[model samples]
Target chain A: MTDPRLTPLAASLPDTVPFVGPETQQRRMGREFTARLGANESVFGPSPRAIEAMQAAARDVWMYGDPEAHELRHAVAAHHGIAPEHIRVGEGIDGLLGLLVRLTVAQGDWVVTSEGGYPTFDYHVTGFGGRIEQVPYESDRVDTKGLIERAGWTGAKLVYIANPDNPMGGLQGARAIHEMIEALPQGALLVLDEAYAEFAPEAERPEIDPTDERVIRLRSFSKAHGLAGARVGYAIGPAPLIAAFDRVRNHFGLGRISQAGAHAALADRDHLAHVVSQVAAARARIAAIAHDNGLAPLPSSTNFVAIDCGGDGAFARRVMTGLGARGVFVRMPGVAPLDRCIRVTAGREADLDTFAAALPEALEEARAAP
Target chain B: MTDPRLTPLAASLPDTVPFVGPETQQRRMGREFTARLGANESVFGPSPRAIEAMQAAARDVWMYGDPEAHELRHAVAAHHGIAPEHIRVGEGIDGLLGLLVRLTVAQGDWVVTSEGGYPTFDYHVTGFGGRIEQVPYESDRVDTKGLIERAGWTGAKLVYIANPDNPMGGLQGARAIHEMIEALPQGALLVLDEAYAEFAPEAERPEIDPTDERVIRLRSFSKAHGLAGARVGYAIGPAPLIAAFDRVRNHFGLGRISQAGAHAALADRDHLAHVVSQVAAARARIAAIAHDNGLAPLPSSTNFVAIDCGGDGAFARRVMTGLGARGVFVRMPGVAPLDRCIRVTAGREADLDTFAAALPEALEEARAAP
Candidate 1:
């Protein structure tokens, strides 16, 4: 007989990766992608100051990172104008989301999110045995009222909404988000993922209180700070919930160099401002490229543009595959309606130039496909 | 009314940090520890090649790490003479332990471990709501037979054992470990944590097949490889179980820089060999220092020595506090009997010299304490 082995929940789970990285695809293709923009990672790169801090910390790999993430948390708290107790730094928002799921979702519990939203959050919900109730987006934006309605009906414990949502690069304004937060059912909590907050206009960003028990906001260095490879993110929430993270988190999960890099990245406001403007410029260029190719570009407040491929999901998939074949890496949404578009990250001039060159050929190949 | 909340299990858990890192202590003391020997981290540091690789990767932080960790996993698999499918790498052994506990230990499930073994493993067990049945250490080593007996009686889903264990530095031979594996109950899997495997004599390390379903062996670059700050560790086990990690692991948990550093560190075998020998020499020096101070140094196969203060747990704690006050960071076991000793990590000559100089004064103060 086989071993008594995994718990039933673990046994039921399929060995699935929510997303395949561009590197894996590159390996299988036996070639490097000339334009790398698949995963919504920052292409402007971390500040020179941040890179230098990481390099300086590289020789100190013997000691484990501070478990409390003291200095980094303090820096983040100061940046957000919150107490250090309000912040909990983690490996990344990906890691933090898993912990949040563990803390709230139990077996057979209900969690709510927009359809075709972040698959990583869904993976965590399922991994924790939580049932995910999907609400279809309203005009390409996460349907806030629909999400609240579903949560109330299903008694969902957690409701996830990514401001400047992935795949579509759509955003909801502060007033809409504030209403959503206030509308949450008594036992429900709003997980506001602000991973792209730095790229959004100030007026569009929410102004929720850090101590609001009804909400917890997650931010990442992976987006604007250009430190995705550094694996640093932080959650700002009520002290009680943030305190709970200590009971379950891999306390030493953040690397010492990552902590150092993050601290420096936070301090370099000029670099962040520069990256934001560059992302805006690149976004405009991407939209222009889409318009030139006879595709429609959705309005974006993020570092990426979602271009409607003017056909079915299959057409979009074909375009993405065509891009892959042409040495340009890009991604698209998985579900219907949203799948009519391909998402491209803001990249450097050279990287965008490569994408610009490859786009016409890729579109031609897609159009020529049976 | 309060927000819809964490699950009852999550709410019921206490906010606890298993180990308070020396960095936190240093911050509290408003000064850095002179020797920095508390965490059992290697003072010899990661290989020069690893530092170079990490520094090189700093500029490339925009990319998220490969979700599969292909190159690093392949390198580790090759080094161990196993197929890549047999290995799963994560943030560290701590992160992997959290994943393993999540996989096997559902609420109210039974798990077994030595009373004073790795606290991080115990933290994971409780975090997952597993009922931990601790078998006391026998004569300063993990009670292997006791653990097996407890597992059988409780129908434990998992049993944990650390070879060349932390805090105590006591080890069991390869034959004994193999026997323990064979004796595991039908419903139980042994989590053989070999975090210190590189430091032990080759004959003392077990020779279990990589395909063994009954056991999962964990190894860490954080230990002898001097990459603790990098947060890289891997598990070697049956392909089925190794595959299950995909369901719950933060797919992009490991940093791109960390993966690069780990690959370079693994390739530098000469650096690893040199660190191992240096750890051994440091262990000998620490033991000699303990003897000179009229304390008993437990024989060690790991990178740290456990010094018996020739008194009770309280006495040992005072000595540890005295050392801490003197800016010589060190740690002691949390439980009784075993707590009679203070754990000191092996450090470079200058670091140990700092410890050697601080020991006598600290001992005198501890001895004079009421």
Candidate 2:
């Protein structure tokens, strides 16, 4: 019998994964890393209360999670000072992005983003057969102006921007973002991903109208809340667009434990304040380590610091490899220019101590490489 | 500014949720379900070892789960006597079904299923713009022959069948399933969802070639393993097709706790066997209850028994509503002939005591209704 026929779009796509986890790297290397600082995960972990809630939720694993994710949605809505109708929760921002792409992007539709912005967003756009128009980052930040101009030219349906951007950890001020939204072409929607909003200063996060049809804000419990492994994220937008997600989403996608954990995490404001302070200290430590190693540390409004290796992409790659060999796990930007820097997440004192101890040797090894 | 423009297909689709979860109903009613037998979940709950594993994993929630889901995938592969490459773990069977539909069904593509088969599968198919061709059930079981015939005539790309069927609890034995697979039209793929496989006799499950390109077998941790709230499901198929999922699936979709729990659950064979025996006893008790109430319980190979109320679709719906009002949550088939029955899940002794106490009154109320 003939093999099953894939859709033309599916057939044309190549098999790939957006981000490889540290676990896979550890398995390949046959040992665990001494410092697990990769992927911008909050090593400080979730609140003790959140852990207790998840543990309690473990006993009720027999029932499917509430399909509507009612309690968690309301909690998130309250936290954002928005009505519950303005919020939609999904497996994560990644899952929600996929659904949004499906809803708005038809084959050959145009979408716009920065050259080395979140690869997962680009992956979703391409998966839905949308053509991407990438504009290079201006300075270390995402070029909002470039993005808006490209969207205008391409007549793109969707435009994506991540505040306090990944890899470089650079922020665009609230006013810059408001201008970007105002400049959006007719029928074009801005996808403002604020995954690290909790880590940024309040003024750096735009205060958008909840009913604004031009933009949708994405947030994650992964970073500041320390619930990355829980797979909880939410979107806030116009009621109609938020409600539209119900039509195409896996209604029962969220796990009961995840919902309980996230809800508890949101309720613990002291823990969030503690995490933000701890992350600030860690980021400072990372920056100091970069300076001591004779490297340049970029300004960061997020949990990670990007350290310029004082060399090109290949030299930086060798430094990253050397760090990995020294049992410190870290990542770098994929595209050039940004690739000159190795992105390091803020970790606990012990974890960063491992990174600090390894930096000099890794830099020496990279400098000595042919 | 104009609102975002949805793709033509998305704009044409209606906003709907596949199933109204019991939690949603409970919230609407402003009370908790007394029996909780509606969704066919294993009230016996997951293995204690699995619960411990999950609770332990919760502490590490700061880290994203292994994108490859290595340990759990390998465990699942070993259980089925197949290579790890043949398995693809997803959020749940529902999530996997959506991905499968995306892979095979393009706009206007044809898919075939029983008229009242799992509605979530149909939701996924239609969400991707595929046209559905439905064949009526034969007796209470999914009509495999009729599905094959329909596929041949419509040149359908995908055909879905659930063994030990939902809503009716009917089964097609191994030989019949093998015949159905053999008769699949060229280029047509069979999506065999065996979510309740652990509850069925071994002889009833088909033994197929792992490399068979014609079919993809789905299994869930939800039903007999009692991890429905954990949202773990897997697909076993040809290596190429299984690997293809990596291209489109959320790479880090599975949660760390879920992976750990499923891995622990798979290792505890005694727990699985105990749950199976418990489900069997509960099903028998439900059948006995139906007989005492002068209703006929269909022969079941699943965790639930479908009892004929000796009435039409509307009457069965009324009976379900009556059960809901009486604090016993149960469901019924959505199509005719089969709709004459209300499906009740196997539950603990106390839970079923509530069901037994409520059934006669519910039936009387349904019969008394206009």
Candidate 3:
């Protein structure tokens, strides 16, 4: 019997995870993947300095992490030239997103996002009983204008827009983003998820005014820093919104190792630049491979690329299955039209080679299978 | 202008944090404490080998941690002589408590906990909009009988009782806890937070079967393992309830370094036993000092001791202040009656010496403050 205490909302909601990890997929499949191209994780690895800092912090895990997150905040502030009050660090963008939802979302409160944006955000909204209004991605980018119009239509309390968006590696430049920001209804907080911002070209990143209270931006060490396994991400926003997080956040959620690793990673700009360069090269290679196969690879500004297979979702599903049977683990979007493509993460040359070797055979089998 | 889509429950709840961290206190004091004793953290520290394992994990922070958490679960299962399905590891006791509440407590759903119990659980209940009915402590031990009675009266969904309770380190024997569990109202789930279990005497720990579906127990690496800073904890329960966590948990919330450190720490029973012995000695020392100062030290099974300082909450506050002024960070309970005592965490010899030296003067000043 279900426990009597669960609220009606929690009780009514089905227990479901947003995205199953590739590890779970592997376990279910009863074998490991030949290439880990799913989940958009960096396989090139983290900075040497970051690794050193994390290793050093391993033994001192007994002491609670500094609750204020002072040193790391100072480092982030110095790096971004913002006061510590403007930055809020959390477990990851996912954890921060949950808190952001908690800060503003209530039963029946409207949350607007692209139909196929991050699923974790969707999970948090429903978990908190928020109503969601979706706008479809226009040509692989978050349809900002459509989003704004819908926000007005739904009178949403919060709106989420990920630049250099996920599922498909497409970006909305700073000018367009800034113009769209001006259109956000007052008191409607914009949650800018910049998990992939590091990969976006310099001109694409909007000039963020730290003192602006209308929006809160989230970034993570998980991607560019190669610290995805470390679970460290921070929200940058106006002092008030950032401070409001203190009122409800898991104060000691960040570990000593995570905090120390993030601080060290932030200081090691040399490694970050190198990883960014490597990722750029990998993206180019991935796009070229798609072109050679007569598939259309969307322009990517992030770690993953969405390749349009020029067919319906069922066809793409067959291709995904074919690839999976060959021990290549890849994913696809859940919505219509977007589901016409398969999404693959940028990995090392060896991983890509595995994907290349597996794709053709899988596609043929998918095409031939009943 | 806020998003109109928020659920009514999320909208009505104010953003609030359950505990003000020691680091925040340090920031407010404008100095770091020489003897960090607040927050009930173990200053004794984690094992040497566990540190090595964490250091090794730092090198691969770029990759996502194993979502299955296989290695860590296997270690815990073997260590406890239970099936792997019986375990669910999380960020810490605090994080797990929040999850448990989410799984059970709902908006206006009745829940029961001791008045002087851990505030984090209450925070979770409030966050989830559960209607809480607090049963006052009976001699600083969670009033188990009262808690059960309240559940029967209010049709509580969950009943939380921490054996080897926090703030006050008193404990009840296993038979008492077992009897309390048997008397629970129909459909009520019992959450036995054993965060301090390792420190409890062998006779005090309940021998309830791990496979029991009626109760879920919590354990952590924070105290006995000296990995409070690492943020690792686990819940033990029947397979079905444990499996349900998979539906809602952040799949990759636990970091790579922490998982590795916890695994290694669990394997090293020698280190754990050593920590237990040291804690016992420290508790005794703290109790003796309380006696010497003409104060009463309540019986303790956990790492900290709650000392009844002569006078009311205000005088206790003064003593806490004087001690803080002298760079010793101790804490007190938030509610009345309980607030009349000061809580001090067990620490290293140097730390205890500092606290012992400072206490007499702090008490004198507190007595004369009016």
Chain B TM-score in each of the candidates: 0.98, 0.98, 0.97
Error of 3 at A312 (Å): 3.6
Show the lowest summed lDDT stretch of 10 residues, model 1 chain A: A1-10
Q: CA lDDT of each candidate?
A: 0.91, 0.91, 0.84
lDDT, residue A175, model 3: 87
Instruction: Report the lDDT of model 3 for residue B283.
Output: 87
Alpha-carbon DockQ of candidate 2: 0.70
Candidate 1, A234-339: lDDT as tens digits: 9999988888888789988998999999999999999999999999999999999999999999999889999999999999999999999988899999999999
Better structure of 1 and 3 per DockQ: 1
Error of 1 at A299 (Å): 0.4
- Give one digit per residue, the lDDT tens place, for model 1 in B1-370: 2224777888877788788888878878999898888898989999999999999999898899888999999999999998998999999999999999988888899999999889999999999899999999889988899999999999999999999787799889998899998899987889999999999999888899988889999999999889999999999999888988987899999999999999999999899999999999999999999999999999999999999999999999999998998889999998989999999999989889988988999899988987
Model 1 steric clash total:
2
Where does model 1 sit among the CAPRI classes? medium
- Mark the regions of model 2 whose C-alpha exceeds 4 Å error after superposition: A1-4, B1-4
Q: In angstroms, how far off is A59's CA in candidate 2?
A: 0.6
Give TM-scores for every candidate, taking all chains together and pairing residue i with residue i.
0.99, 0.99, 0.94
Model 3 clash number: 32
